[model samples]
Target chain A: MSIFVDGNTTIVLQGATGSEGSFWAQHMIEMGARVVAAVTPGKEGQKLHGVPVFHSVRRAHAQHAAKAAMLFVPPRFARDAVLEALDAGIPRVVTIADGIPLHDQIQIRAAARAEGAQVVGGNTSGVISPGKSMVGMFPYWIERVYRPGSIGVMTRSGSLTNEVTAWVVDAGFGVSTLVGVGGDLVPGSRFAEFLPAFETDPETQAVVIVGELGGTMEEEVAEAIRDGVFTKPVVAFLGGRTAPSGKRMGHAGAIATGSSGTVAGKVKELEGAGALVADRPCRVGELLARVVQ
Target chain B: MRLLEYQGKAVFKEAGIMVPAARVVRASENQALRDEACAAARELMSAAGIGRQAEQDPTGSSGGETAWFAPGVMVKAQVTSGGRGKAGLIVRAESPEDAGQAAVAIVEREPSVRVILLEQMVDSACELYLSISTDAGSARHLILASAVGGVEIETLAEQNPTAIQRVSVDPFMGLQPYQTRGLGYDLGFSGELVKRFAQVTSSLYQVFRANDTELAEINPLFVTQDGSLIAGDSKLIIDDNSLNRQPQFEVTREQYGTDTEYEAALEGIPYVQFDGDISLMCAGAGLTTTVYDLVQFEGGTVANYLEFGGPNYRKARRAMELCLKNRSSVILIVTFGTIARADVMAEGIVGAIAELKPDRPIVTCIRGTNEEAATETLADAGIEPLLDTEEAVRRAVAIAKGEQV
Candidate 1:
């Protein structure tokens, strides 16, 4: 019933011999995600949290039948790793590097489209399907935040996801899945791209979006809602409301260029499209309650 | 990083694109340097066959210097931001001495402008716009051209959308010849003019790809009276992420923001200072901005926005030290760490506080990924962290207002 990953989904860990990669690979395994194989160029046959290791994604995919690839590669190599996963025919890929070049992201998106697959991030924490399984950096053991339920969550921010999703759980609801699309100028996939899956999932009765003021992704989500591509009730909390124009508010993509990509612009568009827009993160849970009801 | 006019022209020249003959006059208090700049301007004018009559021989039959000093030279202030022509930062000078005077006046008017570009003004039959930029919507490099040039492309798009013709270039295949030819024809060029236009467009695309440029723009691509196209102005912005590979672009502190911002940039932390009373630091960009909003929503203005998370999660102490330098009444740190461990961030925060204790009140809402250990670390340091972000922001705002927490 989860959107992207579940307990049955066999995952391959790229860059699995690295420190962050190894740590998260163990964490994913601990959370019941089937980590079948690990990929590191030189360190083949090494085991990561009892998972078999291979040098190439194709070799790992051939042996383990991995459906997904989780990348812990650095920014410079992120594009190649994602492309390798896609080339190996892995249906889902998630990259956790935050500093991938914009051009690299463009190539990654094109490759993902051509392969008919989904790549989650270059700056993301990863995706999590609560209770059933998870393939990201989320601490799923925290019941106060990540209890299994029917609401779907898609975000462009990492830390904000934890805070906002905690509010969702606090509102007497839980999440079916949470996807971090990453906060970059060009994400491998966008918020609207995941909406169709959320809409069709019987467990996902409502969706919560943690968007920011930059790029047209939030506006695209609004367009999707207006076009009836997604029919489920949605609640969104947009960040950077008080950010000044022309100043890059931390994220490379999180800048208001000219008049577009402003918080007011996103708010108006989302609200006009019949999605409940929460001004505060705390209000997300309350709005979700109202929308789902 | 946005390159100065002279720098961009140098890059264009490297790419084999045609540009107007130019000389740079750097503003300085040194008298000798000032005289040299004036001399450089005079030399440029003489080279362009336009100079003072006094500098020429009394007899008209001297050298190859032309008698006509008609179109004159252009004195442009070499600032990164645009609207120089409308802001009176660009001036036309009929003589070399006039060009020097114009440069002096421009530098005087805008004291921050340290460089002036003096170029031979081209006589144009018409102007066209051309650029290669990364388009976020299509996730590709876009080639945009228009016959109607240089009145701000955004304004032109709103008023006359069809005037701007766009073609998305595939990242792998690059900009094709047929695409540029089609663009040239669409802009109403024909015969040899179309060929030349296509060449310039293709060369500009090469410049874009070679420079790791986010935007390579030629506003007012002047079609000279003699049917030659020359780039009147160059706007090249190199991708910040690609700076490691682009060693040619030396990012100076002056090219960007204030001292604090530059310092943060060096440490790979994204920080933007504001004119407010609260110094806000968070774990992620989205969270940092949301904290800014909440602080403002609670009627408190933020003095800065600094995020030290993701790859920068371990640099919490460094981030805290930077935030401590801000001239703010209160400091607010909020993070719901996921990939960034809360305990590690707390240790860094505690370490920073112990090393450089400030008098300002500090409020935090550090949670997620070893929250208990993080809370314990903060408590051991005599800093109690709040659980809710809104409550922490309210407390910080109240503390800034000199009210009870």
Candidate 2:
């Protein structure tokens, strides 16, 4: 069983009339995800890839029962779109937009908590449950990377996530659910937030995390591991060790702002908590191979 | 973009926050402009009623200009990099000539110096620190305040942790008056001082929100002898993503120079030059850092780093052109499309290659969203794409190292 989405998950695609939105909507459909409806305000009646489209989430919810919503809206409108998804009782939302204002993300995070909903990203690549359902825009065309395995993958970096998943696949394992929590400073979910679900998923024998410099999310994950909140074997690959101290690297959250965001600080904390940490992405599969055994 | 001290103070003034009276003395390589800047500093000091007395008696044996500083005015060099006070860039002048001389010395030392500010020095009982910045861990705006100021907050944080009082403002509720009062109390303020502190805190938040500021800091929020709070110094960093809403802040990028990353930023590209041989371009910060690490691990040197400029093909093409212009030993473009489409990115790279055609080996790892079409497009330009991320890096490193891939 997958953690976030699966074969039974009926998803609604927001901003579905846009190029990226419609394209991903079609791709999701091809991956066997039930794309029940699409939403674009001006083109409500227009159908994309044979899926019905509505102007509002409320209108779409009234006609079709959807368990999840994937927002392909622009950054400026991401906050309202996530709030709309939450208000419409779509329990899970995955936003693909990047560069949302920090204030907007803060409000979105608060609203999500109040509604008891999970919003994956404002800058994320979306989530994928291999061989089950892909709500995100993963490179499903190369189906070799994800073969429905027992390792759960959660990462802040999108591109690096691809590299790690490729390693996992090559090591004779597959992902139960790979969630991109985004590389932004204020992502909806932290590394610790997903560990519980990974622990509870019987299909997930181990969890692999791809973290980077900046933020204390990795340190929080270490706390979770030490406290026994996550019982599964965990292997982590922390990037940006070679990056200059003051430079932002690539992610807005990937800079060493204080003593906590340093790569050494994160690695020391995770290793201190008994989580095997890999210095490089190529080392992750090797470390996990030993840990999961 | 980070604004200079004078520019930050201008923003603070616009937000109704009180700042010291100051004037900017613009500098240049030309001696005439340099002289004019010094003259401008002299005029500023004269207007503040400090430099006139020193002009009359340069020796100051007759108790002129208080022997050291020009009674009230301070010459502050404007530079983006910090520690100016410790760097001896900031100078206190006792005369208009001294002020001008200070400006000239600073301008001569730092070519990046565009302007020097002469500010009316505030008489203060004590210095306080305050800043409003987003805390990623808590996912909220953090209001950091300390009674101790005029020194680096990092040093203060290291020495006395409890002296710093932090209050996380709920984005929904914002910074309420009661909460500010509690913080003010924690900082040893009460009654009217508490109300004033709360007002300043609220106004600073307004400035931060209205300007789409990533960070707004008043390092030395001075408490004057008369119990009034004045913003002694400030630093403001605008979120580049919010530039659409903040049109006035557009000029902040113009202040950037050739020595800095401004050239790439102007083209809407994220490029950071490194001392290496291989040119690397990719999407996402995580991937960029990982690629850099991987190249290093494989014993390859990266001359430059470029990120695909958002989802726009034009910006991506510009980013490619910039990397191609770097003249590195080999160029590697490893991109994984998620929010961005592989086809669009391929179009960008192909367009750049057809136009620029740097006589160097280029390797690209194209994945996600219409991968076949993207690969075909790259192949049409006589460039073969690597499907695997690891193999692509290995190939690029191998080529950079002058080995067969």
Candidate 3:
């Protein structure tokens, strides 16, 4: 009943020979993700945790019929890898590299749109449907944080989501699917883009969004809710309420500029759109209780 | 990284864009370097045929027309930040000596300005704005053109939105010829001027792509009296992530917001210093900012925002040392690791404490993978880890305000 990835989804691992790719590939396998193939140029025939390796995504797709790809490629090569996956007709892709050039990201997003597929992130931790499959770098074994339940979570930050979701679990709730949309100026997908899936998933009773300043993705979420595109109880916690303008706080995309992309602006918009906005991370659990009930 | 005007002009020149004849004079305390710079300025003015006695009319008039004088040279401070005109960092001088004096005055007034650019002023008939910038919302590169230039584009957009014409370019299909021509016509250009405008914009687009520039701007793309186009000012901001591919532009520590920020960049850690008493070290950017908001909500200000996790998790010790160097009375470490192991972060914090024992109160809320080990490590180091972020933030804020635990 969860969205995006599940136990039946066969995944291909890009950059599987790299240290990060190999490590996360094993973790994904342990969490029930079907890592059927790996792709690393010039490393064909090698096996990463018993997954068959190929030189290209197309070759991997042909041999294993992988439905999704998890790319651990570096920022410089992120565009080509994602395009390669899209070219191979892979319906879903997840990129884990940060610092991908803005121009490259634009191209990747265009390609994904043209292909009618979904791409997760260039700086994301990845996605996880707890107890079904894990496709990202999430430590899903943490039962206190990631027990399978009815709450669907989408986030822009990796570590912050862990903390907020812990509060969600503490409040007697568990996640159906958690999607990390990535914290970049141009994410492969936006926050509102995933709302329809959560809305249709019967297992998902409500959605929790962990958003930040910078980018109009949060505003887009508000638009979706206002337009009745997503008719579910939604609780959001937006960071960087006091961040000074023109100062990039940690994330490249997390900054306030001019009058737009401010926390207050996003909060007002989301609240006006009939969604409850939490003042703090711990308050997310309480807000969800109010809205979901 | 935002390049100085002179640097951006150099990039524009490399792209074959027409720019005014210019010379650079760097401010130096050394007398010899100052003398050399002054001499270079004089040579530049002389080369431009200014102050040549033979060219001046004896009557100082052309029949019944007004008296004609040599065009003044523009003495501009080479600074990265904008608003130089309002700050009086940009001035016009009639002679090389005046230009040198202007440069000296600018350097003396704005200590941050180290270099000055001396350029022959163009006989401009019209000033227009043209730029190629990345539009994050649309996930496309945008070409913004306006007939109203020499002013802030944002203000202009607010005042008269139609004054600016925006064209979004697909990354796969870059600045097409027809798109440029369409923009030129939309900006009120006709005949050969539109072609020339397209040429200049095409060259600017080349510069934008070649340098991996997030923004390549000409605030006043000057139309000379003879109808020739020239870039009156250049602003190029290279993407920081693509700096490795752009070897021509070297980033210095001074380019960063602060010395500590530069140091943090070297360690792959994101740090932003603030004016408060509570220092924060978190695992991610979003968390660090949220914690900052929580602290401010609880009536406390953060001294700095530093996040070390993901690939930077191993640098926790160094990040902690950075927090220690700040003027905060207490340090708050709030981290809930997913991909970043909590034990690794705890070990780094413990190591940093062991190496440099400080007298400030440190509150921690560490969780995630191998939490028991992280908890045990902090306990062995005489630090009890709090599990709740709000409780930790409140405690840190109270401790910073000198309240009881």
Residues A176-246, candidate 2: write the lDDT tens digits: 89988988878987778888888888899999989999888889999999999998888999888877766
Q: Model 2 off-target regions past 4 Å?
A: A42-46, B51-72, B251-254, B298-301, B312-316, B324-329, B339-347, B359-405
DockQ for the candidates, in order:
0.72, 0.59, 0.71
Chain B superposition TM-score per model: 0.86, 0.84, 0.85
Stretches of candidate 1 exceeding 4 Å from the true structure: B30-37, B51-71, B86-88, B91-111, B402-404
The chain A TM-scores for the candidates, taken one by one, are: 0.97, 0.96, 0.97
How high is the CA lDDT of each candidate model?
A: 0.84, 0.79, 0.84
TM-score, every prediction:
0.93, 0.91, 0.91
Better of 1 and 2 by lDDT: 1
Off by over 4 Å in 3: B30-44, B49-70, B91-109
The TM-score measured for candidate 3 stands at 0.91
lDDT of 1 by residue, B1-405 (tens): 788888988887777676776788777774544565567667767676653322222222221222223257888888876688888899998776677677777877877777778777776778899988877656788998999997778778878989999999888888898998898888888998898888888888988988788789999888765466777898998877778878998866645446787788788788887878999878888888899999999999888888888778898778878888888998899998886889999998888888878778889889988999999999988998788999999999999899976
Clashing pairs in 3: none
TM-score of predicted structure 1, chain A: 0.97
Q: Please give the C-alpha DockQ score of model 2.
A: 0.59
Tens digits of per-residue lDDT for model 3 on A1-293?
89999999999999968787788889899889988999999989888898789999999889899888999999999999999999999999999898898778888988888889999998888999998898788888889889999999999998889888988998999999999999887889989989999989999999999999987888999999999999999899999998888788877788776777898999999999999998888888888888775
